[model samples]
Target: MAQKNYGKKLLLVVLGSTVMGIGIYLTIIANFGSDPLTMFWIGLSNRLGITIGQANLLVSALMLIVVFFMDRKEIFIGSILNPLVISVTTDFLLRQTITIDSVGLRMMFFILGLLILAFGIAVYSLADFGRGAYEALVFSLNQLFKRSIRIFRILCDISFAIAGILLGAQLSIGPVMAILLMGVSIQFFINHLSRPIYHYLNK
Candidate 1:
């Protein structure tokens, strides 16, 4: 039974990561903007003349260093897999640009990307395997400050968004919406979707 449950969790992690990659790809192709962390990565990529995947890996590594000191327990197989899979998948998809000339279609894609990203986050949380470096940073800060997860999450996003903007990443509607909506959306999914799925899986 333990083995079976572990297998299920592993499966969830892979699926969730893949879904997240798809969401990331969609948002990038939409050309509106991306989530805070991704925005920062893209900004760094542009400035450094590197691939977004490389920027992502570098950022994740730095965040993981902090997590190591703040809360090492959060580092697990999923932690490594999360960044590796997402970066590779995102880079591959990014290379294959799906052009959308219509502004309306781009907006639609952005909205769909946001939804997919939120759902992927919820799936990852439900698996309980481990969190990515950014998620771990948020959780660690929440633990240190004794604040609500939602508050820290929003703050983290805002900070990243600001930094990204300062680093020359375009501040657009998509990023603004992401900053405002991501924490709330993730919480909503945890309450309405992840918990239910967790209960079912454990049962």
Candidate 2:
């Protein structure tokens, strides 16, 4: 059997998603903006007469369409729950403020927030329950281009970020950091945690 059991995988998915939401909250708190995907959702929500949460739902729906065509299996499970979980979870957590009254405190939260996001994604992938929308799309692009996952991720993220910015999506320090750091962070955390965390979760 795979080292990670189904129950453990489910737990990790929820945990990872929760962390992703926290990271979004941190970006909002930092006042430094969020990633392109996030910015796109927020902007779409604002302009299209939808709540940010609802906008996220819409984005997930569109991505699921692409994902189903690109990799039917990967989209199969996540399509059912990942977007709904991420959208609702992020909205709830981000709405709850973690008040920080100082610049130093805010900066600290920013860095910590990034790390939390990394851990969440790492756990989510390590669990291997299903692929997140962004991750799945990057993997699909890599397969299509016959390129490395890392390289493809970087390229896609940059392209998406630029596009989101051009479309009047929020683009600032937090998002810039996310664009630069998310890939490396996810890679690092996944590599380091996959086996050990899986083993621990199973047992």
Candidate 3:
């Protein structure tokens, strides 16, 4: 029984994490804008002349170090799996993007990307694997500042977005929309989706 549960949990973790990768990929291929963290990763990729997935993993690894020092407990299997899977998934999807000539279609992709991203995040989180490096960073910052995690998250997004823009990453109203909506959207999912999922996993 426990064995069955573990397998299901692992599958959920992988699927949830990979869906997140797909969402990020769609947002990038849309070429409108991306979430700040993604935008920052893209900037790193450009400046470093590596794939965006490579840059994302590199940053996640670096953040893991910081989180390790701040709170070791925050690091979990999901922390490693989350970045590794997403990195691979993103790079794999990179070659799959098609050239879209229609603005309306592009906007639809962008919107779909945002919704998918929120759903992926919520699902991944519900898997009970662990916090990713970025999530850990938010937790650590909240502890350090003794403020709201939501506030720190938004601030982090804004900071990363600015840095990404400075590094020649493109900007659009997209990042703004992401910043404004992501937390709310995640909560919306958690509110609606968590109970059923948690029951299934016995979480």
Candidate 4:
């Protein structure tokens, strides 16, 4: 029974990680601003002359350093898998496809992508495998400040976005609004779906 449960948990982790890739792809397709980490990857790629996937791998490797220092428990197999999967996924999504080009089309894709991303996050969070570096950082800050995780997440995300902008990353109203709105959108999904996912998996 214990082995069975462990296998299920492992499967959930893999699925959750794959869902994360989908969320990232959706973020790109939305043509709005990407999440802070993606913004960082894109910014660094532009500044340093690396591929986006390579930038992501570099960032994820550095994040592993922080994860080891701060909380090893939060850093597990899925942590490695998530970035690797997303990089490949994002690369494929961007290169092999022509995304919506028109302003209205882009806006629609952006909104729909946000919702899909939120759902992916909700599922991933509920899987109870491990938190990504950014997620772990938010959790750590919330614990340290005795503030809400959601608020800390928002603050951290915004700070990263600003940093990306200053570092010569692309910035427009779409991405700026993402910094403001993503937290609320994610919180809504978390609130509505987290419990059900938890119970389903735990059972």
Candidate 5:
């Protein structure tokens, strides 16, 4: 069975990738303890004496390998495309040297980043082009347990935060708020956003 509207799916993947990258960059620059996975990345980087980028790659690769055995079908174009596109987008943005000085403004960026990140994740996940290693695990658990992804996602988020803390990553209000909201945010998009995307694709 051939997949229809694969080109559109790919577009979604790219858009999601770029959006996710921007979201990630914003969250990090906001500096409110960063995103959950990012907290873990920082911990891993410091623990291993490697660059943050190196730690990120290592974690993602290991995650991808795990998902590969868990459900290879979830490994698709987006799986590869997600990290590459996000890395490029974030790298470029980093070079821009974006900075926010206002506490209020930083908070705004964090909130916006969290929402956009979840939306981006939903867009690409709905595209059926596979998912990033982090999200692949989320959805894979959804399939395996036949439960709501929100529950699994919440657990995953908290677990990462705890691990990051254990590894010396500071916990803050921003990441804590994000940990609570991220799962709900992603599910919200999957619920609301999937309709239009799938509608366009099926047409």
Candidate 6:
């Protein structure tokens, strides 16, 4: 029974990570900007002349190092898989040239990307395998400082957004939308989607 449960959780982690990757890819192809972490990676990629996937892997690795010190308990197999899976999947999707000429269509894609991203987050959280590197950092900081997770998240996003901007990544509406909606979306998914799935799986 324990083995079965572990396998199920591992499967959920992979599924959630893959979905998140697709969402990330869609957001990137939408060309409306990206989430702060992604923006940071994109900025670094542009400045350092590396692929975005490479930048993502490098940044995630560095963040994981910090997470290792701050909260070793959060480290798990999922932690190792999250970054690699998301980056690789994003890179694969990005290889296809998906373009939208109309602003409305582009915005539609952007919104869809947000929904998918949120859903992925919700599913990933449900898996409860482990938090991703950036998320683990936020969780650890919250624990250390006794601050609300929301505040730390906002601060992280702002810092990354600014750094990305400074590095010559274009600022756009995508980050703003992500900041505003992601929390709400995650909550919605947790309450409405993941919990039910968890119940079903457990039963």
Return the top candidate by lDDT. Answer: 3
On a 0 to 1 TM-score scale, where does candidate 6 land against the true structure? 0.95
User: lDDT of each structure?
Assistant: 0.85, 0.73, 0.88, 0.71, 0.82, 0.86
lDDT tens digits, residue span 15-97, model 2 = 77777777766766766667767777767766787766787788778776787788766764544566677778778876675
The residue pairs in collision within model 2 are none
TM-score of 5: 0.84
TM-score head-to-head 4 vs 5, winner? 5
Q: Which tens-of-lDDT digit does each residue in 34-139 have in candidate 6?
A: 8898899889989999878888899989988998888888878888888888888888888888778889988888888888988988888888888888898899
lDDT of 4 at 143: 62
Q: Give all TM-scores, in the order shown.
A: 0.90, 0.84, 0.95, 0.82, 0.84, 0.95
lDDT string, candidate 5, 62-135, tens digits: 88998888887878888988887777777677677777899999999889889988888888888888878887
TM-score of 4: 0.82
- Name the runs in model 1 displaced over 4 angstroms: none
List, residue by residue over 1-203, the lDDT tens digit for candidate 3: 48777777677778888989999998888888899999999999999999999999999999999989888788888888998999999999997758877989988898888888888889888877779899999998788779999898888899999999998899898898888778888899889988898788875
lDDT by residue (1-203, candidate 4, tens digit) is 36666666567666665666666666666656687777877788888998677788888888777767766677766677667776776676667676577888877767776667666666666666677667776676666668998788677677778877777776766566666666688789789877776676667
The segments of candidate 6 whose C-alpha lies over 4 angstroms from its true place after superposition are none
Better of 2 and 3 by lDDT: 3
